[model samples]
Target: MRSLPLTPSRPVTAASDGRPALPPQHLADLDLGQRQTLLAGLGQPAYRAKQISTHYFGRLTRDPQAMTDLPAAVRAGVAERLLPTLLTPVREDACDSGATRKALWRLHDGALVESVLMGYPDRVTVCVSSQAGCGMACPFCATGQAGLTRNLSTAEIIDQVVHLAGVAAAGGVTGSPPRLSHVVFMGMGEPLANYGRVIAAVRRLCAPPPEGLGLSQRHVTVSTVGLVPAMRRLAGEDLSVTLALSLHAPDDDLRDELVPVNQRWKVAEVLDAAWEYADRTGRRVSIEYAMIRDVNDQPWRADLLGRLLAGRMAHVNLIPLNPTPGSRWDASPKPIEREFVRRLRTAGVAVTVRDTRGREIDGACGQLVAAETAS
Candidate 1:
């Protein structure tokens, strides 16, 4: 995998916005009437909030020049204050013939986060980072290995999708979808760890146009490594986002080794929380298993996993472990992977292998940022 610059850097301080960054309160960050209050404080009428919202979310334009509905006098002030930029593009690399593209962004505080946009025949999905880096120290995960930099603000998380939606609108993807239809929080950070901001960002993303992106709540997926309390808390949001449990293994012995959080919550506790969420939201949970060779891929572990998930309102997404540089972990062999799937199916669990995208572009979560930091 090689690095490609998406745009030229303007100027950045050592803190990386290259300039004094404003406090994080972009228009995207606010709730419904909050923008009106912001504009009213600026001595502008309340209706200006709707105009700014329409410009950002409806037309997907960040340029003041493109916001013709607003007076020229207030455009700069409105953009500078209400819609200040949160993420600066460092670079982006595309793979899968431009269908799978990964972007590395530099946050105002110099924390780097990554997002991946994958175009399919039916839908366009963008995997966004909820935090700059990850705190969950999963040994096999590159982001986890790096440790946490900072939790991304609601605007920061929202920025990833808004920017990519503009890209898609410009026909940046191979299949040529002009709008984002699905989003997944399977990027750099443990989403539940940054609970409040992540939840706010979810609301902002699912809110109808002129308020948020207006995507279906069902199309959104938030992944976690089984933060038990947070999982239970999320079920109460009535957001209806599909909860994906990053359950790399079944038994506590192996899981505690693979997913460090399992040491605290244990495998059973996590699964129970996931089932409770499914019951509450009427949404099927997604179990994420990264098959690693000779580690958690043993036949007995597969059987144990199947037994744990058997007859649950869930589907197992078998991820062929994307090998990280200098890491001992690697994807399971084809025969072994198939056997793992077979065991789950025999146990009456629905299963499918994840499409391994952006391999050539460091598409795996945190791979691109890790490479950047190392350099």
Candidate 2:
């Protein structure tokens, strides 16, 4: 008998021709203002370092000359050391009339994750990754199939947003500095699995101008696949970021197959945990249900889901599953999807279908990186 072909095991950040991987040092791993102190030790003043950081973090400036306040001799050294490159884009694919762009980034460590920039009429939302690869083993997710690599440091995660904000700021998109109006941690990995760093990243993200990214906590959303302990742990944090649970199925039997973690924490445990979070935070919980063609999309499941969420302050985001190449699962048909929405609404549940952006460009959670793994 022949052995099964191994799924690609290498990180997705390798050079296109498969060269040695680069190592990325995360800024968050460093102490507060340490990057500045490092420069100060090298003959630059503390305030000069702050100026450089202001350009990078506040103004979203990547270019060194943009820091005009700095002396000519020392600016190069500051840029060389403090601005050590983090992620270099391996490939960028765009669909949806340039409104949706997916980028496969190669971190210095060769670890790979993805981020998506989506332009809507009202707001521009960036979907960012919290971990390099995922460990949750959700069968429908490409990253879950790859397994976990490591939790991205706070800076590694924020670099993605800052990079995009830099681009948008440079191009002058909408708001005065082309601010990122919204952020979602729904891209590559199980966010709560990497709780500590994720929380740190959230702080750095929601921090006001000059000190941090300046995005509002209300505009940020963090998602998880029902890590019960972590969810409860997060509720205690005082941060106002939205919490989204990938509760693909309402019952344990089906959920165990859809999201294997259900075997560890059953449906009741997860919902109880979610309700605890909502009660604690006074924020509505968002339940994410991916509608698979014949699996987990039944009317009975829809009503069950509504019953499960009925009296709670909750919102449902129904995703039409974006089929991966050769995967047995596919998105639900139109009529079934509409009926599912109708039944939920009839039950007085608030729900909406995800716009399904970037479908043409492997827009499902982890398809682009998965394809890179396959190649």
Candidate 3:
């Protein structure tokens, strides 16, 4: 009956809290000039950046042994100095008969993050974590429960995409190759909270071959719980990736409790920021609302949400709360869910239920917190 208690959280930058980055030599962590500088220091030609980037980003192969194009003598040196191994898979779980696979990665410091790969008919999507855990204390989110570990380096974030891209290219699970088409930052961390590296990582993902992995900027998405300044900053980046604002509740009173960051930047402010993102990128912003039973799912709230989103150049993704183990929150009942959908439609707001994947696998972002603790 009383409002849920607020939990403390803060925005994380690229190690702005004094968290260390991935080792300096990590190539994906380095910029173009930095990579070239590292290469020159190794007594290798600057042009090797292209060859190395070709092998790593374009081909998605991390093993130096596989790059016969590089002179065998320098391959090890290039890899050693610029591309030290970042993630080692700790466990891999698959469901939907392998159409969906979740990987738990152990970072160099033994910090763990999770990424999910889902294959649909025409394309594959990888959900990557931008931080090791998460700092935003959204009460219903599993990642929010685990708290912040650290912001992932650009390389660590890219590694998730690279590994999954490799999977798609090789027909690893489906037995027929498909290009990895979509990337969502809806995995573990508060993406905008870690703004610098996240934007840099986006650049690396969208840059042309030999400089980046060359994925189209349009296919990528960055999500946040309304970090206002960073959202404004992102609008000016000239990158066209979709911005997903996790607006779990319509009113600031509820949102302040649900998405704690909403305490600092309330609902209207966040929505205004989302609109600016749409205006700048010419991309429809994505509004993500998680439906929690009897908590934020009342019909009146749906109407409130509809009014808020009615004509915005945005799409609503309604997520049936992936109830964490032993948690008080649960998904809205089926009929309630439908009625909620109907209310939004009545208001002419476009909305769709996001497919609830990887729940049984504890692959919903930091949902692995419960699973890893049990193990």
Tens-digit lDDT string for candidate 3 (159-247): 88998889778875563347787889988899987888888899998888778888889999899999999999999988999999999
- Candidate 2 residue pairs in backbone clash: 22-108, 23-108, 24-108, 24-109
What TM-scores do the predictions have? 0.95, 0.89, 0.91
Cα shift from native, residue 92, model 3 (Å): 0.9
Report the Cα lDDT for residue 357, model 3: 79
lDDT of 1 by residue, 1-375 (tens): 445656654454452655445446789889769999988999999888888898888878877677887889998898788877677888888888888889998876567899999998788899999987798999999999999977888888888998898888888889856778999999999999999999998899889979999989999999999999999999998889999999998888888888999989998889999999999999999999999999989999889888888888999999998998888888899999999999889999999999989989877888989898888
Weakest lDDT window of 10 consecutive positions for candidate 3: 1-10
Per-candidate clashes, comma-separated:
2, 4, 0
- Where model 1 places Cα greater than 4 Å from the true spot, the runs are 1-23
lDDT for each candidate structure: 0.88, 0.81, 0.84
Q: Report model 2's TM-score to 2 decimal places.
A: 0.89
lDDT of 3: 0.84
Off by over 4 Å in 2: 1-36, 172-177
